[model samples]
Target chain A: MQLISAACWSTYRIFVAYILSLAFGIFYGVSANVSPKREKFMIALLDVLQSVPILGFFPVAIAFFAAVFQGQRIGLELAAIFLIFTSQAWNIAFGVYETIKTLPREFGEVSKAFNFGPDFTVRRVYLPAMIPTIVFNSGVSMANGWYFLMASEIISLGNKQVKLPGLGSTMMSYLAQGNIWGVIASIGTIVLINALLQIFIFRPLVRWSELFQYNATGSAPEWPTVVDVLSGLGRALRIDTFLVSLVSLGNRAYGKVAKYVIYGIGTIVAAAVGYLLYWLFTPPYPWDILVQIPTALTVTAMRVIAAVVISVLLALPFVIRSVRNVQTAQNIYSLASILGSIPAVIFYPPIVALGGRSYMELLSILLLLTGSFWYALFNMSKGAMLLPGVLTEMSQVFNIKGWLYYKNVLIPAILPPLITGALTAWGGAWNASIVAEHVQFGDQVYSIPGIGSLLTEATSNTKALVLTVLCMTVLIVLVNMLFWRPWYSRSAEKYNITE
Target chain B: MALLDIKNLNLTFRENGKELTVLENINFSLNEGEFLCLVGPSGSGKSTILRIVSGILNQYTGEVLYKDQPNPQPNPNVSMVFQSFALIPWLTVQENIELVLEARGINPRQRVRTALKYIDMVGLDSFEDAYPRELSGGMKQRVGIARALAVEPEILLMDEPFSALDVLTAADLREQVVNLWQEKKLPLKSVLMVTHNMEEAVFLADRIIVLSARPAHIMGEVSVDLPRPRDSRDKAFEDILDKVYSMILSSRLGK
Candidate 1:
């Protein structure tokens, strides 16, 4: 009964959260693209949102929402759902935005020549163009949600604690009582759910979405898929005709109300922005929180830099191996996806069991590794696969292979994606620190000195929370501007084969 | 009045804040039923002229008049076939043909029938359900032509449509296009095509407009007097090709 209830609650939260993120992502992503003036500002805002750790704001969300709802279960549930939305929303929005930017110039000409209205363009062109990207990132975001869901489920600020009824809480309760079997069962159940989703949902989606794959050319698979069989049956039974009629009716209904609805949404958004600006300027100046920033930042920065360097080194060899063959790349990719679904924090209980005096730092590094290393590996391998046939042919003509191949061809080719992967990896590492820098196993809790844990501790006091957020945002912006910007531009100039 | 007119056309491009003039004082016009070809040295703004006339680009200091009216928006009576085919990959040949009709708010069943008719006309009867990715380059261009024709526009603009296809395929398609126009099955009253191939221009055009190099201007206009299905091997055809080639070659020099 408990297990069923936990599953139900978890499912409910994820369902609501996924819809919210997807809606917000599309709404804001399209809005940003349509209005050219806000494009840069909106893009930058989304970048900051993604980089800001969700768990860092847990205390603020809990405190505010709890007061708003008077400590009701609904308030906690809303908080959990919002946290999940933060995890899933950014990537989807970025994917949508990126797709809009990169659509072929010819697509624009076709739209103009055909004189397609906004509805036709959005439904047939933009939406279809967005499928593979949305699906791929949704997989990534779902994995992201799993990691943060655990932390959000069991929220603690000072002496106050609220534990939502879900697998995360169930696992925590089991861990508190030293039920190793319970942990195993919970993990097993997670693995089972992950596998089932891949089979029923993701695998089919990725395959089905290939209809919208941008100009890929390969012979049709020799074997038929379940979708093929089902579609064939639908055709045979005239079910497709019925479905099309139903859809067109829905499309007509949507078209009728879409304009008024859009205007309504626009007004609300403007008011919200105006209100947020007002709140932002009406600050009491929580100047004291700046004191903790320097110490916590230095430690966290060191950890992130170390983990990123090690992760890149570790993932590089895999990129070479994976790119050598398609089957091998697919296998490696699926493994990463499975591993990604299990948050790095889940490894803490076992790491805590293997006890030592200085194990916390090592454990933090290990946690950081899981959070980051796969991104580089996945990205570089995918990038390597995109190496043009002519470049490879030229390399082969010149007898480029082994370390020489890496030097002459592979490294330069994968440099852009490598940098991109490293950027996201660092972002994930920053988010992971909220749990990595502070670990709880059994009745005992271990804490380390870092910005992640500092923010975690600061959550109890509103003033500290406010200042911590401000200081951290400034630190992140400065690092991005000073460090990553030059590196990105240099690499882009050197390796932009597209031009 | 000419079916289409481009007057005092001048175009410039800004790349990284550097001004580059692409066309200057480009004057041209098309009579009804004329197969007009714009032939110039490579990178001489031939396609740029085509785009301006199509009203796809308006930044140039010029006027493009369609039926003697200044075309502010893209003229619905005109249609274009792009050099790259521009067929959306996810859409099938049938769907691509129907896309324009759908934009015009045609019924679904009528769209299917109309699209199939054009597909047959393009000799792509069996390939209607195939995606653009599934089609060969030559077949893709044929689809491009069919899509343009599907709109039933009065003016058709083709931008180096055959330049990406094989020579034999291009020649075959050129003949078929001429046949389509000669048979009066195509509703288009005028065709304006851009190409660098001298033989292609001489082979198909009623009048070839020769253009100079960068900041392209009208160097000359050569009228082809050859009979129907003008054989490329014939002395008259070779003379025309020679004349156009010399005009383009001299334009490339300090002429």
Candidate 2:
């Protein structure tokens, strides 16, 4: 009966958390993608968010949320939702950004040439392009959310420990009490339910979207009513289609108004820049939290460097191998995708078992680091594969091999992908560290002294503190300035093959 | 006297549960310094013959004898310039040429020197550090030529190298190629090229071998008696071009 109740609560939390995170993710991701200037900043922010684990943010989330609604009883739910939101937001945003940036130019040009305008473009073009990518990210993010669901529900700060009677809280309670059977049963039940949900719900959605892939090859398959519903919405809005038709009608009636179209774009750009600048100056929290920025900035710098070094080490060999041989390269991709989908927590049990979770908790930390490493590897390999076969043949004909080959050809070939992956993985490591630092096995708890552990302690004691919020904001800015800026500038200067 | 010899070459490609023969019982031989043009209708295995002779393709029944010795496999001794100016876009003109030197473990300064010499040789010295994408189509082909030259190959095989260029550029590139061939004839001992343009074939080739339609065999061989630095408008060149063009067109109709 308890298990049944626990299952119900877990389901409810996962569903609510997934939906909220996915929504915020899509909004940020899509917006950043369309606005090229915003993309770097948004992606940097996401990287910092992803790198810091869910448990680490709980303290600040609780503190801020609790202060706003001092007497409110739904603080626990809000905290849970926010944790899921941050966990998924970065990934979803990344998915959106990646999809948008990679969308076929021909498709975009074709839409524009036909005078589809903004409304028709978003409905018929952008949304359709984003669906498959969005779904993939959502599935991956839900898996990420589950890793910390147990930690998120039970708030512990110094003397105040609150269990919200959800599956997460129940699992924590069972684990704390050394209930072996209960932990096993919970993990098993969660996995089974999730697998079933995937097979029944998500897989079919993914398969359905494969029909759209044919459009790129000029042989679009029958898409069913989804496209119709979107087209209908576009028509009802009469925004892009209506405005464009009106413009076309005017062009026929009175010959040309390109200035008005240009003015509309100018206005949109002005509004976006104004909004971004405002956000940059405004602190999400009070002035007191802003004072703690320097320490947080230093910590973030250390973390970003550590993540980059670790992830590159893991990704480099695989990338080189993939570039040298095509068949092995494909296999490497499949391996990365499988590993990428699995949550970082799966490594925790073996890590704690093997390494005792000390500062030299080398194995666990490596595993934690690899959660991001695999992501970098996947993107790097894909980018390397994109190097034109003709270019490769030229390299071979010229006999460019080994270090020179990598330095002159392969490095330049995959630099953009490498930087992008490194940033994304840096974000992933931040999130993974939260779960990695805090390990509970057989009535013994071990934690490393970092933001992850601090967050865990803050949440455990239910101390509504602004520590996490302050740390995250500082980390985001520092990452952009210290890492992404130099990298992005270098990429822009080096790889701009404007044909 | 033969620099390269093909002994009874037969090529087949397997697709969708059936083996399709593209080249059947092909035979040819060429002496040192001779320019050979393998011409036929598209899909008559002209490119396949270059690929096989260059050792790019090995799934065939044939012996490509190099200096009276059968070529075993693809190697650097034979270099091919693809129809698509296969220049590595990321590398600069100098770096692209230096790649072969690097792979061969030549000293960095010496490699740069040699690469620069070749870049200058191809008249791209000013654009030595420019990327392939930044260069014109003709310039990219020059880089391709320089890259092949840097390898110090015994036989130079070109697969419709001028096809992707504009007519004026193609003519200009052809003139530059013949001049280079006259000037530095050591590395490129013999040239075997595939061309759809009959004029290009007639102007460059000593002997133009035409293949029959698919399951391609030697249909005929036309020897170009035109002198060195041959004019495209020369009666002999035009007559050979007309004959080869009709043969290719008639072969297509036959297919």
- Candidate 2: misplaced stretches above 4 Å? A1-12, A32-54, A63-75, A101-108, A164-167, A179-185, A188-307, A316-360, A381-387, A391-408, A434-472, A496-499, B1-255
Q: Which tens-of-lDDT digit does each residue in A100-198 have in candidate 1? A: 777888887888776775566766677678877776677767777776668779877458777999877887777777787887787666667667767
RMSD of 2: 21.3
For residue B178, what is the lDDT in candidate 1?
Answer: 88
Q: Report the poorest 10 consecutive residues by lDDT, candidate 2 chain B.
A: B83-92
Query: Which consecutive 10 residues in model 2 chain A have the weakest lDDT in total?
Result: A212-221
The CA lDDT of each predicted structure is 0.78, 0.67
lDDT, candidate 1, B1-255, per-residue tens: 599888999988899999999999988899899999999888889998877766667798977887788874777888899999998877889989998899988899999999999999989999998888788999999999999998898888999999999989999999988888788877788889999888899999999999998888999999998889889999999998899988888887855
DockQ agreement of candidate 2 with the native complex: 0.01
| Candidate 1 accuracy as TM-score | 0.90
Looking at model 2, residue A257 earns an lDDT score of 60
lDDT of 2 at B82: 72
